[model samples]
Target: MTTDFGLKETGYIAPSFAEILDGVEDDYRTRLGDDIALTSNAYLGIFARLMSDASYDLIQQQEQIYYSGFYSTAVNSALDRLAGNISLTRKVDAPSHAEVVITTEGEYLIQAGEKFETEDGLVFDLTEDVITSKQSDGAFQGTGNVECEETGEFTNVPANTITLFANPDEDFISVTNPRPAGGGQDYEDDETFRKRLIMENAARPGPTEPGIKSALMNLNGVKQVGFIDNDKYKTDEYGNPECSVHIYVLGGNDDEIAKTLIDKCAAGITLAGSIVKEAPDATGKLKEVKFDHAQQHNIYVKIDVSINDDWNSDAGVDDIKQAICDEINSLEMGQRVNFTRLYSVTYDVNGVDDATIAIGSTKDKLADQNISIGRSEFAHCDPGDVEVDLIGL
Candidate 1:
C-alpha cells in the first residue's frame, strides 16, 4: 500500500497596491476584451488604484491581527481588561531618588526645601534644613539629606558632583551624594508587561507561594525575593515562631516595601524583624514605629575572561564585567551564585571565548564554591567587588 504525507503551507506573500491594481486591471481586460483602453482612461485608472489601495490596506490590517493579536489596540485592550492588568503603554514610571548630603560653612542656616544642581543640570531638593555650627577651631560643619527633583535613571548623580546650590550662593554650601541614586525606571516594555500579565493570570486564584512570589516580583524596584517557610526557622531568639522572607530590592521607596508586605503576607505571620510603622497614641499624636532591615552580606566575585584576538577591545572587556555584575545583582536571598552559571554567562558574552571564575582567589578554580545567603540576610555585590580581568589580549 502507498501512503501520502500532507505538508502544511508555511509561507505567505502579501500583495502590494501595484500587484492588486494589476490583477484587477487584468481581470477587467479579460472580461471586456483587450480592445478596451484600461490604462489610458484617467477615471478608470483612478478607480482601480483606489480600490486596490483600499484592499491592500484592509489585507495588511487583517494580517496584523492574524499574525499578532496583541498588536491590535482593541484586542490588546480587551485582553488587558480580562487579565486585570494595566496596559503596557500606560505603565507608571518609577522615580529615582538619592540622599544628598549638604555641608555648609560659618553657621549658615540652610533652609528646608533648598535646591541643588549638578553641573549637567540634575536637580535635588533638600528634605530638611540644617544648621552649621562653628566649632572652636572656627570651622563650620552640618549635613542634610536631599532628593532628586525628577524621576529618571540619570537623576542618580555621583558623589561630590552636585556642588552647585540652586538657591542661595554656591560659595557657602557644598553638596555631595555619599551613595548613588537608584529606583528610577521607565515604563515597562511590551514583552515585560506581557510576561507579568501571564504570571499574574497563572497566580490569580489565591495566595499560593507562587502567587506571593509573583506579587512581590511585580512590585516596582524589587529585583528578587526568597521565602523561608516555618520549617526553615524553627523558632525566634526569644522562642517565638520565626518565618522569614528575604528581598533583594533595587529602587522604589523602602516604606512601600513594608506596605507591600502587609498587603501580601498572611495574617499572624511575622515579617522576621521589626518594621517601621506609624500609629496614633491615646493622645491622638502620631508615633513612629521603627524596625531593623534584614542584614546585608556582600559577596566578592572574581572573574578572569579570555577574549578572542579580534574582540580584545575595552568595550568587550566592559561587557563581560557588566554581565557578571548583572547576574550577581539578580540573585535573591538564600540563592546561591553558581560558579558554573557564572562561567557560562562569561563565555556567552559576544567576544568572550572562555572564562575562569574564582569567588575570592587568584587560582583558576577555587573548588567552584557558590556563595549562599542566610534567611535573615540578603547578598549584595558592589560593582567594585566584581573583579574582571581580560586575558589572551
Candidate 2:
C-alpha cells in the first residue's frame, strides 16, 4: 500500500531538523539570486529558521496521528479508543475490601458510612448497616463488609491490624478486621492495557484458557491469576481432578470471580477448589461455582551495602527496601526470583558503592541464589522484611 507522510516499509520516517533548515535555506537561495547573502542574523535567515521549526512540528504531529491508530504506539485516550473497537475497556480503580468484626458493649447499629482505621491512619468504611446482638463474652459482635478509603497496594493488610473506629460512637466500642482488607485496585495504566490488548488479539474471548484469565484479570482488585488444567483421564500429581481447570486468583470480589469462572468454563470442565459458592448465571439462575485463592509466599531479603557520605542512613534504608519489594512483587506467579536482581535495585539508589544480597523463604535461611516459585504460589516481599545493613566508607 502507498502511504503518505514518509511512510516506509520499515516504519514512519521524518526529516531531521538540520535537513529541514537546509532545505529552507536552499529554497531561498534558489528562488532569489546567488548574490543575496544569507547571513546568520539576516531577516531572511531568521524567517527561514522559524519556517523550518514550524514545518518540523507539523511533521511530528502527523507522525503521532499515524501511530495513534496502532496499539503498539498509541497512548492514553488514543489507546483506549483503539481497544474499545475490539470490545475491551480499561479497568477502573477498585477499593480494598475486608471482613471486619464490629465489637460493641451492647446492642448497636453500625452504619454503612462509619469507618474503622489502623494506627498508621489507613481507613476502611463499612459497606452496609448491621445490628449486632450481645454475645456470651458480654461484647456484641457483628458485620464483615468494609473497604479501604483508597485503592491499590498497601491496602491489603494483615489480620487484626484495624483496631480503631474513625468517629467515636457511644454505642460502638471497638472494631477490628479478622481478615485483611483486600481487592483494592488501581486504574489500569497504559502499558498494562497495551499488553492485555495484544494478548487478547491472539484468541477468541470465551470458554478458552486465555479468555478465562483475561476476564478474571479485568475484574476489580484482582492482582495475579494462575491457570492449571488437568486434562488427563486420571487425577493429576497436584491433586487436581481429571478433566478440570483449576484457577488460583490472588485478589478480587468473590461473587464476581465465581460468576466469571462459571460463565467462561466449557461444559463438563470441573472447577476445582476447596472454596465453593453460589453464583447467579446470565438468566438469573443460581449455579454453584468453585475456584481457589492463590497461595501467597513471602520472600525475605538481607542487603549489606557499603556507602559514602551522600547516603542518608535513615531514609535510604527505607528507599532500598521499597525498591526491592516493588521489583520482586512485579514478578508473575511461578516466576523465579533472581538473587542478582536485588543488587541492581540497591545500586540504583544514590551513594551506594557496594552491595551484597541474599534471599530465602525463611528469615533464618537466606542465600544468594534464585528462588523458584510454585505454579499456584505468588512471591512477595515486605519492606519490613528487607534488612538493610549499611557499612560506612
Candidate 3:
C-alpha cells in the first residue's frame, strides 16, 4: 500500500531513497549472505539512486500542495465573506484645509485658482476667487479658504507661515493662514483594519451602543466615538424634550456622522448637537433636519523621566521626551491616561530607569490620578506640555 505523504502524522519523517536502499541491502545481506555489489556502476545502485531522487521530488510536491491550500487568497477571501468579515482595503486620504486672509494694497481681484506656498514647500490652492475691498485701515482685505494640494496632517502648520504667493502679479497681496489646517489623515494600517472588522462582526443590529460605535467607526479617520444617552439632561433651546443621543466623536466628517445618526437611529429620536441637513419629503418639498453634536474639551498631560547611568548618550534626552509625547498623542478620545502605562513606556525606553508622571500638573503627581475625560472631551498632549527631567544616577 502506498503511504499518503500529505496525511502523514505530526513529526513524521519521509524515508529517503538512500535509507530505503540501506534497508533493502540489509534484507538482501540477511537472505543471500551479502553477494550483491552496491557500487555506483552496478544496476542495483543506479536504480536505487534514481528511485530516491523521485521519492524526494514527490514529497516536495506533496508538501507544496498541502501548504498552498492553507494560504490561498481566493479561499481565504471566500471564507471571510462567508463569516461576514470585512476584507482589508486602502483607506481614503483626507485633505487639510485652512482659511487664508488675503490683504492687498488696493481693490484686487484674486482668481479662484490662485496658489500659495509655505516655507516647507507645501502648496495650497484657493477654493474661491475673492474681490478684496478697502478695510477700515485703507488696505484691501478678503478672506479665502485654501486646501493643501497634497493630503496628510497639516494641522501643525503655524499661523502667518503662508506668505509666498505663486503668482508674482499678486505680489501686493499678503496671505496668511489665520488658523492651523486640520482634517488630514493617512491610510489605515493592518492592525486598525482588523480591529474594525472585529468590531463590525461583533455589533448587533439596531441603535445600540455597539452598533452606533461600529457605524461611526466605518467612517474614515474616526479614531474614537462615544455615545451619551442624555434623557435626563436639560431640554434643548427649541423647548424640545431632552431625550437625545449625544454623540461625541473624535476624527471624522461632522456632516457624515450626523447623517449616520439619522439613518441608524429610530424615528423621533432627538439628536443633541446642531447638525443641519436638508431632507425632501414625499411631496418633493425640502425640509431641514437638525441633529446635535457633542462639544470637545482638550486634556493636557505632563511627565518627568529619570535615566540610568548606563544610558546611551546618542539617544538624546529629547528622544525620551518625544517618546512620551508620542504615547500621549496616540491615545483615543475620552480614553483615560493611565499613569502606570506612562511609567511602563518610560521603563521600556532603552535608557530610562524610572519615571514620574502627572496628567494635569507637575507637583500634583501623587495626588493627581489618571485623567478621565468626559464623553465630549478628548485627550491631547502637546510636545510643549510634556516636560521631561532626566535624573542621571
lDDT by residue for model 1 over 242-347, one digit each (tens)?
5644333444444555555555555455544344555554456654433233445666777777777557465776777777777876676656667677787678
Q: 2 or 3, which is superior by TM-score?
A: 2
- For model 1, which pairs clash? 274-291
Clashes of each: 1, 0, 5
How do the residues 153-211 of candidate 3 rate in per-residue lDDT, one tens digit apiece? 54335567878888766436588986455445666554555566656768843477788
The model with the greatest TM-score is 2
Q: Which candidate is the best by lDDT?
A: 2
Instruction: Select the stronger candidate by lDDT from 1 and 3.
Output: 3
lDDT values for all models? 0.60, 0.83, 0.63
For model 2, the stretches where C-alpha displacement exceeds 4 angstroms are 1-5, 33-36, 101-109, 131-141, 167-178, 232-237, 306-319, 347-353, 390-392
How far is each candidate from the true structure, as Cα RMSD in Å? Answer: 8.4, 3.7, 7.9
What's the TM-score of every candidate structure?
A: 0.58, 0.85, 0.62
